[model samples]
Target: MTAEQKGARLANLWDKTLAAGMSEPERLIYRSNLLGSDKRITNYGGGNTSAKVMEKDPLSGQAVEVMWVKGSGGDVGTIKRDGFATLYMGKLNALKSIYRGVEFEDEMVDYLPHCTFNLNPRAASIDTPLHAYVPKKHVDHMHPDAIIAIAASKNSKELTQEIFGGEIGWLPWKRPGYELGLWLEKFCLENPGARGVVLESHGLFTWGDTAEESYLTTIEIINAAIGWFEKKITGPVFGGDKYRPLPADERRKVAGALMPVIRGMISAAEAKVGHFDDSDAVLEFVSSNTLEPLAALGTSCPDHFLRTKIRPLVVDFDPTNPDVAGTIAGLDKAVADYREGYKAYYERCRHDISPAMRDPNAVVYLVPGVGMITFAKDKATARISGEFYVNAINVMRGSSSVSTYMGLPEQEAFDIEYWLLEEAKLQRMPKPKSLAGKVALITGGAGGIGRATAERFLREGACVVLADIDAGALEAASADFSKRYGSDQVRSALINVTSEEAVADGFANSATEFGGLDILVSNAGLASSASITETTLALWDKNIDILAKGYFLVSREAFRIFETQKIGGNIVFVASKNGLAASPNAAAYCTGKAAEIHLARCLALEGAEKGIRVNTVNPDAVLRGSKIWTGEWKEQRAAAYKMSTDDLEEHYRSRSMLKLSVFPEDIAEGIYFFASEQSAKSTGNILNVDAGNAQAFTR
Candidate 1:
């Protein structure tokens, strides 16, 4: 490929035969998905596409013009037919009569429902008018980084003219609303030959006579920007990196160490999830000399800063010197200063109708040597926030290299951030689940009890990291949970709870992947049934190593993470009724269980002051779906009782005071009680789910 051809890397992905089969509205969906599939074209849920189509009116029995556009909060890339809102073209144009001016643009949002065609329940966004007034068969407005770099530059207007001549035009800065839509209409009328326009400090808008033309035009415009920057930007990007980035492993270690500390500070009001980014682009920007100054300008685009707060807090660790301890020590004051500064910004920009001040903590944190860390209400939002910041970094890289990079004016940013309409949108959101922002690490997580508990937590909106010794079970279990709960909410680690290093590494994985750990379920175990005289030293040691030492190793790691976060944590130990009741010929198993129960009591005493709670759940006769019972223990125990292995269940059921049998799910509920706030005030307590065994009474 030639240099110019190579520079234009974005391929026109439209399939002509496919478009030939789709209706106009279906074609709109097709075009929207094509444009949104690439982040370079638009960030997630950031852009809108529309198509004007002729449809048969159900009421009038005549062909009527209707505009189908992406609905509010819908991502174009994943949207289906139901995701677009249809509005009567006549009703939409009629809105122009009652439309006051820029000041009353927000009120126009109320009138959108009145223009609904065929009663599309999908609400229209504020950008509806922008597409409605374009006077074309198809229109697309996108936030591609390459185009936004020029649009966000100091001389964006001049750059547009120089790049595309009269075919594409440039418009001055105007906050998106009905007024901006009118401006677009006027621009189209005056410049009849124009194919598109660059909205200064905003994004690009392209139109065409067909859906294919409009989609292709959007791609070509973005590639033009990319190609121009490749040739025009000859200088070192981001003022050349001032400090070399740490090795990838070292960067991750620092991020893991810092995330829990930061999450603890910011998650006071509401639990927040964390996302870390040390991609090449992020590393380049965070380690650069101009990182501080450019970050101070914040972001030019509304979508960029909205998810990533108004500005990021630049961490004070110099990569060359590498003082992690010093950086952590100073974070207390650094966070306080950022919060105070944000409050001051709110106070200065508040209007009578403005919404109340939101969380003042920085959503984005720029650590020099490592990369970027973002925290939000949930994992998806947290991850998306990081992705948006990377887009901003790319835009800044280009604009700063060629022309002066600029951020949105503070007042405008404040206005948009605290806008009453935005506030209303937030209010419309549904209430969060019980464990919405909580993350858990379940040991022996591929086993029956652990799997049940993980599913329970996941159903309540918590992110789960399943750590198990069984490689095959872990993979299958992880894939199952990931399919049911989103992949973002589920992760797995191959961990031997008896190995201190493996246990610690599992906790580290939990911290970096989902911010930090909140709950630890120590469920890894193996049972041995043998008379004291018959039990070999190896059997005794194996029982103690896995059941007792394993629990200790995992809990120690949990305590370390919980202490670093300074956030209260939950540790639920799955012991056995054998801990209290004497079971014949299983001396080693009973001794190991007793040790596990006692450890819970000791840890509870030590953790009380730190708000960490340790509790024990004693389960017995959990015969169904149990890995331990499937082994020699079942035959050995049955042999000692003078019964077949099949009769062991009947023996246990008949021996119980309630004549009931226990299952893994029963133990799962007992553990859940301790993990949840339902048992918040009661710690160091034991809950028995052993079919009411009189011999196992804790009281």
Candidate 2:
């Protein structure tokens, strides 16, 4: 296309965005979408966009100018109008003059609400003032990797001017707040021709009288910086890839071996209790040879400083090192050193900020051969932090092409890390679900009850491993769950829970996959319905081995992992209501379930002091979608009961006091309670999810 034709087409597209009769907020949404839709421009919650629009004040009956800025915590990529907060521009700007004498915390936080024209629940982005201070009708702020590559480099200021000349303004690193906003406002006024300002070690900001102008200016400037960056490079960016990675299998083995050791140490120090996060991406990045220096130099930008911290804690990974005393002692010491180093870093600058020392634990842990692992209070944050680091690595590698990559000075990083407004973003967040950040293992996980339980735990934000003897079914279930709740959070393993070796290997491998295990749902079992006159020794043994012994084997392995980590875990057994009220022609099944229930009680008593909680969920008839209630087993049971399969199902459902059929999902809820903190003070408890089976209820 001709340049003039292309410009006309671009103008038409821009006009389409404003579509006739659209409200100002709608236009803002349209423009924000343009900025957020590109992950290359902004990731998850890494950027904010705003528009200055006039709206009628319901109480005052007068038109008022308001700043509609992106709110805290939601991803801009999918944000709605409600995702943006409205603050009176005049009021917000007025605070800048008087904000000088106020306590930095109060000035930064306490007065924010009074300036809100529509004081809604959502908090405005920390960059609200930066957007408001600009006299333009629209503003765009983003952490585009290309711009960050330039802004985070050692000679960012000089290079920035070199690339854009006087068209861009430069603001050295300042934590986002009223002060930085005021500084930006003054800079823009002084350099009215500048298209945007690059906040050093932060991100890019562009503005114009219209959304189209601001958005295009952001794209145009970043593109220019990237073009300049490409021209500067004369050689390989990653120091020529001198490092060779271990084979994928070997990498997994190494990661599996070292993750728990790292997790245990960090969990104890940072969380005080719970498992740390480990992922395949982290493994790949840490295993890369470039990780050490790139990470040591610190986060690529300041926005990331709050998420990934200044530097990742690097752990030495020697595959030849045996997994005995020396290895354990060395890893423990490495973690201790990382913690102490962080404390020293904090001590050097804590007096500059008012907030107490944030958790001194490393958010990112880099291991030489194995890979990197990141930790957070919850799985989402862990995953997000890991992603940011991965982006940082790529940006830093790219930055090396032009010049050596360097992050903000330690003091600047420290300021952003403990900045009260940044910390308050976390404080204002709603509480997470009970099982968030937890790891759960479900045996017979391909089966109905097991799959339901796995789904429940995953929905509550737990990393789940589905362990089943049926390899085909296990693969299918794993694929479905992984698709639903991220492959990073779901895993599947094949194991005969009745075999000690298989159980041990399964639990060990799962613990390696997720850093550690927090909850075990022993739901694997076999069902047999035979009278004493016809029951065979094999039938009785099969039921007992799987139902009773399977629970024992799996729970024992789980306890070993939990005990090693000392994180206090949970074990939930899916027992049958038959254990409570035995039915005719089910001797083997009843005996096995009865034994399992009692075993759970015994484990509850034994594991209490160790912080392990054991509980049982007794489910009656769960015929729908159950693998156990099919084929020859179904035929045999129907014949024994002298009723057709349909009749038997109806009979069970109607017999319940609630006259409703029980399902795997119903049993799953009861099991979830025991697995979550909801039952923190309860143990040895038996919950009957049999649709009001009074006979199965236990006090």
Candidate 3:
């Protein structure tokens, strides 16, 4: 059978499955499995689906209804009945009445007491109310690649209009959950017959009276948009002549140098929000492009601004000059220009409504030949923004064939970029307020440790700057965080910690970017294990440079500046390991960690006089799914120990006195305490959050 026939058969099967009079629980199970099975429909935990089930309450004579929405932390495709949070529809509607125009996080917290659930379940979807507001009995949302591919295009509005016509109502991107629900509620009331709501820079939301109807409508709408986009943006095959390969060594060097900056930028975006998207296509596109202007195209979607800023750093590398200082200076000037232009756009767009602050939430990096690096906090966000740029580039290139694809006017783009309502939604999130006025810089922020630490700082109210060495990962991570936190509270930078000049420049840039730094988490480091006999000088130097010297350089520069000028007693938390105090089989790895701990101790003594507190958190075998314990290293350790991977993991956990695997989040909490006023009298202290493994002092 043809592909179309196969799809039709699947659709028919889905319809029959739901029509079998399955209970709500069984229906949800089938629906989730169907959605999860298709990557083209949803990614790992990417999309959400919900069904409004009406049931009679035991106590009351009147019938009670609850929205069985998808719970947090579960993949839509594999979600079960328990994954749905059963919320009283009346309570949610009542919340709308009491908190009309009020902040969302506040509403969520205020209504938490009224929600009758296991309470231990992850928080409800940010799009809960939006789903509840849909008049249909079932609702579905997805980051379908084909749909978003069209949405990311510059002419998405036009394309959407052509395909969906009056059936779709478009809503500009807003932080999801309550605000999105409110906007969706208002739109539904206004456009009575609207089949679906298309969130610009976000994803599609469709609903229907039946489960199959909702699912089918979603697929149909997305397919329509994809068809329209493909027909309009066709291109001929250009292979051999178009492909250019760089020398392997040069490519590696360029990739290494570019990684941290891109990662940092991405991490910063996520620190504010809570999530980002890291699609495979995004990573391939950014890494493959080796041109100047083409690389400068900003994020694939607006949500990416939450990860990688709006644009990338434009690098003009001149082989003849090879002046690092000159190249950096030029980049700085370009950023300044972009910021000024952004401000001008905001000013022009401002009306009687509240205006956005002067700071540009995102940055565009222009790296000549190596393409552009779009950095954010989390992979998801960076991916979305990167996808937006990919689509924009397609439009720009495709438009050259047709009429030029006209982008939103500068003022219009600025209006949405700096929308006060969107900003307000972020300000109202439910998070701790300890780091409110402080600025923090987190390195290696896209990884598990970096992401957790950044989240901790953001929770305590710190305006965080997350930096990392993996540009793609950083952008994806930063985007995720920025969506949860306000964009203003977080910014990402791309910087290499090993380079003294780069470190200094990054710090200075951060100081200017966030006003001044108050908390510095020098959390970026690496671990490489080699038996003493097999250790090479090159490997030793690389490990020491990244883990030991890198910490020294970042702390030295940040401490002096914070002491000399700011006079604001800053907090510096270096992520060390139990390996610093205990002997590990890997000599170079242990030495580098030991050196980092000593450096922290010395900095603590020196910074104490300036009222700055420097401390370190020693975490051992934290097993938080980081790169250190993945791939070859994990396999090697398991083999050497003569145990299965699961056994090895269990052994590590059992070694901890508390019998709990040390989590990056646990270490992040320790960092938070040291950075916040809670540890006001604490300085130069080494806190071991290794679950008592350190007390035993065993390797």
Off by over 4 Å in 1: 1-8
Local accuracy of candidate 1 as per-residue lDDT tens digits, 94-195? 999998888889999999999999978999998999999998989999998988899889999898889999999999888888999999999999998999
For 538-566, candidate 3 gives per-residue lDDT tens digits of 98998889888888888887775565342
- Per-model TM against the reference: 0.97, 0.84, 0.50
Flag clash pairs in model 1: none
| Ranking of predictions according to TM-score | 1, 2, 3
Candidate 2 C-alpha lDDT tens digits along 65-171:
98888987767778898898898888887787667642463466667777787657777766777788887888888987778887877788988898889998888
- Judged by lDDT relative to the true structure, which candidate is superior, 1 or 2? 1
Global lDDT of each candidate: 0.90, 0.77, 0.62
Preferred candidate (TM-score higher): 2 or 3 = 2
Q: Which run of 10 residues does model 2 get worst, by summed lDDT?
A: 1-10
- What TM-score does prediction 1 earn? 0.97
lDDT of 2: 0.77
Better of 1 and 2 by TM-score: 1
Q: Using alpha carbons, what is the TM-score of model 2?
A: 0.84
- Candidate ordering by lDDT (highest first): 1, 2, 3
| Better candidate by lDDT, 2 or 3 | 2
